[model samples]
Target chain A: MKKVTQILSLMMAIFFLVSSMGNAQSKNKVRKMEYNSKYNYEVATIAVGVDGTKLVKVWGYGPKPEEAIRHAKELAIACAIFRGFPPASNGAAAKTPPIVTDDSVIEKYAEFFDNFFAPGGKYLQYVNLSTDAPPTGEDRVKVNKKTYKVGVVLSIAFDELRKDLEKEGIARRLDAGF
Target chain B: MKTLVNFIFIIALALNSFGQAKKPTIMVVPSDRLCISKGFSQTFDNQGTQETLPDYKKALQNDGDLRLVISKMSGMMADRGFPLKDLEQELKNLAQEAAESNMMTSSSSGSAISESPIDILKRTAKADIIMDLDFEIKRQGPNKYIVFTLNGLDAYTSKNVASASGAGQPSSAATPEILLEEAVLSYMDEFNGRLMTHFQDMFTNGREVKVMIKTFANAGISLEDDYDISGNTDMLSMHIEDWMANNTQGGRFNLSDGTANFMRFEQVRIATEIERNGKMRAQDTRMFVNELSKYLRTNCQIESKVYLRGLGEAWLIVGEK
Candidate 1:
């Protein structure tokens, strides 16, 4: 009976330790993926909204469809601020220059951006899914056994975003005369 | 305590003055290619050469599409806080001035002075930047689309400062104007960004302008004439160069060409404003040349006449007004 109790206590300790370790590992993975998605993603201007917004299609990767979709929003805003859309063939789409022209600005304003792009953070205010339905099979693809890639169309209030950046002293205002 | 208050007040005044900096005035015009392609150009004799120029008056009167396009672009720019000089309004003003001038002929010769439409526009508008627009509508079966291009050219230098071009999505029911509006909306931000960057660069490097120094045929003085100032004797041209070096922002300017009677300074970067009477005043090529004229009068005992061609080029003819 004593041996069984000791074994049961050891098993409980082991279970708790394993669960906490798994949680730490998952947290680390999320941080790493966030950093990767911030720098690496594909974004294209799908359409422009009449009310000073931009509809961009961005591809984001994660371990699940829901996670990928969340990353897609973050990537969409990041691309709009840093990597602008390329000119399309036959003049199909206009070339949009990035809001932040300086390449080193991300690193310089890392703290501000980190807080801005955090989960359920200020970046959510600028962007939303273009459609009411969730992404379908084609839009959500399994890139590997452990990773899923999702394409999302997000409408970003680009002008408002630019104004906010200018207000935050990250970007210069067009009317800020010499 | 009174002295400290005065010091604080002076600091506040200076800060307030700095906030009143000027912005470049913008005017929208049809591109030369658009005018020529749309049969809105006229042939003119220029010093024995046949030259073609855009007939802006004809274009404005005949083309409804052009009017809509210009209105859309100007409205968009105005919304962005840029000051715009309306082309159509300026044209009317020109016509009124022409009629008035025709009635008031010269009393001695009974002849009236005439100016070309382009010249009148330039003199009246004096825009620092010209936004040249070009566009074409394309059709694919029942669907219609528009391809558009906008070029921001420096009015003074005629250099392309910013440009945006693209095609709008094909639509079955959208008008050409709507298609153009869509295309411009997508590209205007980038184009405006480039424009603002260029303007900010002017703040750092100064505004680019041209200056030419000439001597009157009967005037005894030449650019090569030596002038003595503060125990330093130098040619008038050298003195002018030294003044330009001292007064120009960052001492930036180019002596593109020089002769005994003619000296042309291209890429003369002049300050946008200067301090006078303990206050800041706006400056242009005219104001800049006026300063040079004053300098010559005060230091070299030389009288000069300043002639300005629009806002960018100035001629300082020594020994005569």
Candidate 2:
């Protein structure tokens, strides 16, 4: 009877462990986009990155690394143009990614970006500038079989800190002896 | 039942067809003179010696402070709304390339020599932001007066707004703290509010607007004979926040309320690359202006004024540079 009890307890522990792992993966679904398409074809790569920290999307795909990079750049630029630089129009979500372009690589590109920025990866991407750049700690993410890299997304949210930005004379760089 | 099902389907489709607003990111470029030294030899020399420019550093620190201050400026022009996920990867990739170049791995994939914002600044040399600044102190009796010259401020399409590359001296006699404060304050007054709009037109519209102011610091200009003190003299005369703003700076102007449906005049800067031999050497001042214009262009409407001392007036950006 004692031996039977021990085996039952062991089975319970394994079941719990498996359940926890499943929960963890589910939580990470948003970070690492699950393939939404009907098919999971043989893909050479499926990397991901954030959309300027404004929009969290996945983006990456190619038969090779260069092709993946090209697809990623194309996706990133589409996002950039959608935001439209400096944002003349107000009431717009500052950190949200612009409308994802409906292109051939949209799905893979968005996924790559989302994974690149989620959770960790700050140390690898941004320059310190020694200014008020947001905290980009030693966060890392691995994609395309490459070692983990910084995934921190820094967006200077000036609206919240408008008073501070103006008082610092940020525009003085244009003049003499600046 | 059929109608309700169709309505629900339409609602779902509508929700999917929306754009999530986003803030853009802007990487600022420092002044031109501070970017690189004159000629390749000077660049090689100063870079070889790592002595920090305490004054320039101070100014940069001040700009950092100002960035905080401007974050408070309301309406459209605020913090640079950036798309981080997309940009971070691009920057990371670029950073990787840069690291590879520094390592001198010529065979490395994506081995292009990545330019730091500073490198970009130097390559484009000219812009509204002056790179290097110089000063000459002349002791007159009990008071020591300093003459400061700004270099690398490019003029616009017309020759009216002159570049301050060689020198445009503005004299002053104030304490160090006061000198720095006054220099920033006074200059800002000359270029804030609607003035930003006016400035943007010059830069993006093809017309340029450049101004140089020289002020004296508390201790006066110290160590005047430094070889590394030459400023980057070619900077843009104006600022353009929009692509369509690029127009030729010339011809008719009603001058009514200092604005018109379309207007053009001089008082501008030009953006021209300066290169000698097959190797490139210099860039015009518009580079910095271009950077600044990015901030403003994102806005739908801009409202501001130019203030000199206590006097202020509303203005607008229009026409070509």
Candidate 3:
């Protein structure tokens, strides 16, 4: 009977110790975002830099890292073109209008606009800014497959772009600053 | 069926009217140079900063040019049904009250709640808009003409919402008062229209409030720290989101930017209240920072110091308590 009593006391002590340890761990445990594991899709991230007057930032994503970066430069050029020749009348919810051309008397030159935005284009010069690291914190989402987020900041002389855009009739030369 | 339709129509009308805001109160003051030239300004220290502000007290003293201009402007506004706040009279009252209160309260225990002169003016008058006048009487060959500039500013933000400037046709009026009045009245319609449009936008879209939240560098704490074991979100961040949603009318707030240690909220619309200063009143934005600070202290267990600039922007530091 003495041995049995000693065994019971030891069991009780072990149970309490386990329970307290669990409780302490639980006290410090925090919640984190849950992402789907079933979807094997790549997540693309883009962040815009809006500070420099003539420098515009762009980001693109692809299957490979280099391809993603190359795509980002193209995106940067596209961004510059859009910024220069922005549709003034379009509201946030407005639908994109179809581009049309007469083709005989006037050339559409859509490809010309793209060529200017392309890397080493005459109207624009590219200056690469620092690449952004992945966002950190509890809110950061995890993806199942390999993902790519590539970006670049292009330094395009806006005055040149403005003048070219005006010549192309894409933008007016009226002074925006009063 | 007819009675039911009538009841529904009445309800709709009431709801429409409820969303509409009443006319805002306005106060007119001469521009700094004009005030100084006309002897409406005085030199004084605001808190620890020594600067010159318009002394409505001296300006309101009997038979001053600023007083005459303000009175005429007030009459014009009153005729248009817009409420007018007399800055001079209000300042005088405030001075009298401060003197009386100071005599009764001992110096050892200064009032825990102290307001700056501008704050007292804002609190008392509850004027939403301040109209600043910069006028000069130009002496043409045979007549004296008024060359005036009018700026409608948000009392809280100090943002110039509307402005108008033009030279009035020369009038052979006997006094500068009549000449100025005639000049102002000539453009008053357009000026008042601009003022009304700005106030209407504020009423419909809600007033803009800019808020910046920052944490101390050495506090061993960040906005991303998880305070609750059962939740995954950061403690301060979640609380800020909830506060912005709950405090703004109709959840009318935009979280413009957010990072681990900083957050910027723009276009926040706090519910405006009609406060009385003497008999004049307007919708006021005073409750925003007070309520936000109180929430941070109570719920997050984090004390914050709120720094308000003008009326519309508030800066809060979490570790500065």
Candidate 4:
């Protein structure tokens, strides 16, 4: 009975020590301490045309600073592509009648359009708009204990993006010049 | 075979119509401030203090001038697929809810009573926009003229989306109703045009959402710094800015205010879920903030606490981890 009690006490001490070590590690963790923002992008408009150059901004979250930066850069490119090919309808269906005379045709090509409008399409040729200058980093925000948020800004040539879409037959070009 | 073909054609048209989303709901209310200023309200002594308020009940019952205008406007909106929310029905529901809640939460000692906040009225109405109507009649020589103004405001944000004011030619009409209608009819197209323009902008840009970024003073991190988490060196601010640009519809967002410790983003289009009257409706605003929180959690291992105010505003605190 005495031996059993001594062994139980020894086990309790080891368990307590391990638990305290875990607590200490959490308490002493070196976190990224990133800023939490409500807005998506910062404003830096350098007008080159009537519509102005689209400044595609994106945020990247990663366990490391580099990962977040890389992710943000990728997001900026994706945003530019998506912005270039926004939804055809802006909820004006009530005022304007449906353009698709045959619903079945739209239904058939719906999947193709969905895939076509994604980040990278086979028809799209990307011209590096970031050629004007290298990407500018904005903030380093530390999220929980492990993650960090980094912001990157890229100047996407909206004119070029529009021209590419029209050339690819994805969009119809208007006669009115910008 | 002809009948079957007709049936299939009808089905196709029905399906196509169903694919379109419902139009936004609008509620029209007489502006209390305008009514008071124009001497259209009632004044009474409350606790020996004189108080004046819009006599909408009396106006609706006895005055046909505004009533005719509302009826005509509502008819036009309904024809355009925009549904009108009844102010009387909304008030009735509010009163019923208040009575039921009061009965349920009655204390044993009868000392504690719960008071409902003013915001509950907005939620119960469930209107996407509120159209405030104001009008004034002026007498010039032997003729009387009416001038009217309509202000369209977003229900959640209380931001004016559209506004227009116009006056009608002086008429010898005996009643205010006929004269007011004539005045409103002259500029109805212009007023409707402004409203449609605002709605189209909102539909294209996405509903406006206010985003605020706050940093803890003790976080030991500045907004403009190279963060080295996971062996990556990048300016954290730029990454956040990029995320905002990517998520918003048409990349439409405005960074109205930014500092090392605080950042305010206006017109951020984030799809959000709003809980109203015990039912969660798919709206947008909270979703944007949630997306930011999720990105931080997944990428930076940073945990964020989100505090949502109403439907269009969100506050996020960082560096708490």
Candidate 5:
């Protein structure tokens, strides 16, 4: 009977059980630690080419880091879907339907892992790591569609802060020369 | 005197014959159907356009340290000998298990990093083995743009201060989402690759095996919440394992890119039994497990004990992801 029960139970488990039972420590572990970020400034301004190097800005604002990450992912997807990232008034607005709901962009990004564009970037690699040397103007990075020159920066906003904000002017460098 | 010496020699020989710790036959192989890349799940839509991360919050929430977790998690699966079939099958099983357990089957989900410090040589079974890999992050400076230096930290506990691991410190620009992603991804790559390898090996030998991974980590998204400092190791291990032996691993994970998706454990262990043609004695199976454990201890700092059970002429296996 014991062996039969074991077999039946194992079979039932095999048939239906999805998650294994976990008996972890009862106490919840919550550690609060902070470290200096290595990536450079945060604010980034991208130039939209066509109407004489006009800057097409992708605005990202959030109260928490989750919100910030969520915002950043949305902006990345928007950049990918739209022909010119942050399609400025000057450049063309190539119509492409948003891939996911406004609420589910981060879930999409977390589905995979890779840094193919980082080292292999030849055009404009806009890596905004929390480091000292933030990606700067005309730097090279690889976008989903193609690579381009970009101006990347990282910074933390403080109260009554100075205006480190920026604007850019761009046209399809592919068609028109700088 | 001669008899006494002989007895001592026999005991010493017995101890020495078993040898060292056994390395896990673990691998994180790529799924033949999907590839996870850069916290993004890429799959061709009916229109042939790549369906990428549309929900950035889901992406960020699940983007728990892809690179760092892959790198560090590889250490847990350093044995490099698990059948590839076992790795792949087990990872898939664990995923199905996730669904069974009613986890956040949201389109994209990143699990927590919970470490279980089991007794090195505790009660381990041969049919199913359990292990816990613990890691901590260290920062070199402060601010959102500060440098982060990682190291293996040890947790300490006092009367008031329960414990600390490595160099636990606070940062000014602490983003729970970012930190969780970084910590989870840093050591998970090894797991992804190994899963592929382990499964490949299992299938190659015409044996069916399973690998279950139990994940432990924090869930809060606030910098103020100490998600990293929490504990859920044992429960996750057990839960994840239970999920795998059952067939149900397809969650919302898109594996087209092959880098972002990883193994998650709820509260169970991964159990895969191979039905082979031959048969073996229980003692012999134990001996093989003993040998494997001995080999692992020397090659990788995984575990100190091993268990081996008989299934026909084969063995059910478990290892790190």
Candidate 6:
């Protein structure tokens, strides 16, 4: 009986260890998926301002409209830095080049980006809602029963954002003199 | 140790300032094809053969739209801190110079020297890179759009260093200028990025130029002549190649063609600057070839006359001064 109890305890310990390791690996995979999804959708420029600002429409997906709308702001900033707007049919999209071309920069400066993109972080200072309220009608869509796809138009202070990145050593300055 | 540290710090500061001081000068011009298609070209007799060339003076003076476009592009580049040599302004300067030259004649021969308009512009501007712009406006029913192309070419070699092209979205009431501005805004950054890369490469690997070597008809020496260098017999051409290998940046150069009397060294990577007398000085094709000419004269007892065409090409005529 004693031997059986000892064996049972040992088996329980092994099971917990294995399960925790599996959970950690799956968590990393989920994090990677989330990061990639932020850049997967297309961002289009609605209007370009002469004062170094760009009004861009970005799409975000979440379980709720409010969550998706919030996520769209983050996506707007991310697309500005990483993935520039793609050309759309009938000249709908203004195919602006991204401020930073190297994608590996995210992984290289992971800590910096993580903090810069945190909730209510420095990225917020560069982008704002072009309109007073969240977009409705065609801009917001219910994808299936569990998810909402929301498109938000945000005004991004592109030049200021680029200067900030340069200050932070994340992007090269134009006048740095090659 | 303390004095050495101070000396090192000063040196670092000077080097940093030197790196920041140099930026490529750029000029924007309408592409030759665009000028021709828009009927802004004129024919001129070149050695008895009539050749059509872009008449930049006429284009700049007659086309208000072209002037506006050039100004817009120049403004954009200026915003990025690039020094721009305005094409229209340069053309006017050339015209003024031509008028001044035409008023004067040689006292002995009663003749005046003439240069082609393009040559005069090249000598006057000396732009490191030329931005060639071409655009077309297309209409679809009631909507109009613009497809534009921008190419950055090396002023000396005419090599395409950077290029960007795309079509803008159609609009019902957008003017050609608006469409062009929108189209270029998307790709300008990438184009400038490429231009920067090329300029940086020039600093690292050296500025590329072309060198040609020729022997005068009456010269007794030829490139095939054998030279005794430290008991090793090598041809005169071999000796010249060795010098090029030693002097050029990373020994980077191509001997494209060689014969008994002629040698062509294309893509010769020469240093942009060199340290002399404990000071860094700017270098060019003339200075680079002058060093080679000196080497030939001092070591091989050969005299050569170096004739430079523009800033990137040099011809060394052997056996003569």
Name the top DockQ candidate: 1
Q: After superposition, which runs of candidate 6 have C-alpha atoms over 4 Å from their true positions?
A: A1-32, A35-42, A45-49, A61-64, A92-95, A101-115, A137-149, A167-170, B1-10, B19-22, B45-50, B98-126, B216-220
Docking level of model 3? incorrect
DockQ of 6: 0.32
lDDT per residue as tens, model 3, B207-226: 66677788878665677776
The positional error of residue B1 in candidate 6, measured at the CA in angstroms, is 13
Model 1, residue B268: distance off in Å is 1.9
Evaluate residue A112 in candidate 1 and report its C-alpha lDDT on the 0 to 100 scale: 97
lDDT of candidate 5 at residue A49, scale 0 to 100: 23
Model 2 off-target regions past 4 Å?
A: A1-178, B1-97, B102-138, B144-174, B193-321
Flag the better candidate by lDDT, 2 or 4: 4
Number of the candidate with higher DockQ, 1 or 2: 1
Lowest lDDT 10-mer window, candidate 6 chain B?
A: B16-25
Q: State what share of the real interface contacts each candidate retains.
A: 0.63, 0.00, 0.00, 0.00, 0.00, 0.33
Q: Which run of 10 residues does model 3 chain B get worst, by summed lDDT?
A: B275-284
lDDT of 4 at A121: 50
lDDT of 1 by residue, B44-90 (tens): 89999999989888888898888887876777677667757888788
Residues A1-178 of candidate 1 have per-residue lDDT tens digits of: 9999999999999999999999988986885776485467677777776767887888877898888888889888888789776654445567777788777878889999999999999999999887767588788887667788888888888888887998898976776654
Clash list (residue pairs), candidate 1 = none
lDDT accuracy of residue B50 in candidate 4: 98
Write one digit per residue (lDDT tens) for candidate 6, span A12-49. Answer: 99999999999987976775586367547657777666
- Comparing 4 with 6 on TM-score, the higher-scoring candidate is 6
Residue range with the least summed lDDT across 10 consecutive positions in model 4 chain A: A90-99
DockQ score for model 2: 0.01
**Candidate 5 lDDT score at position A126:** 33
Q: What is the TM-score of each candidate against the true structure?
A: 0.81, 0.23, 0.47, 0.48, 0.20, 0.79
Residue A80 displacement in candidate 4 (angstroms): 40
Question: Which residues of candidate 4, in runs, are more than 4 Å off?
Answer: A1-178, B1-23, B38-64, B105-126, B155-160, B203-205, B214-239, B259-262, B269-283, B305-321
Task: Report, for all candidates in order, the number of backbone clashes.
Answer: 0, 134, 3, 42, 189, 1
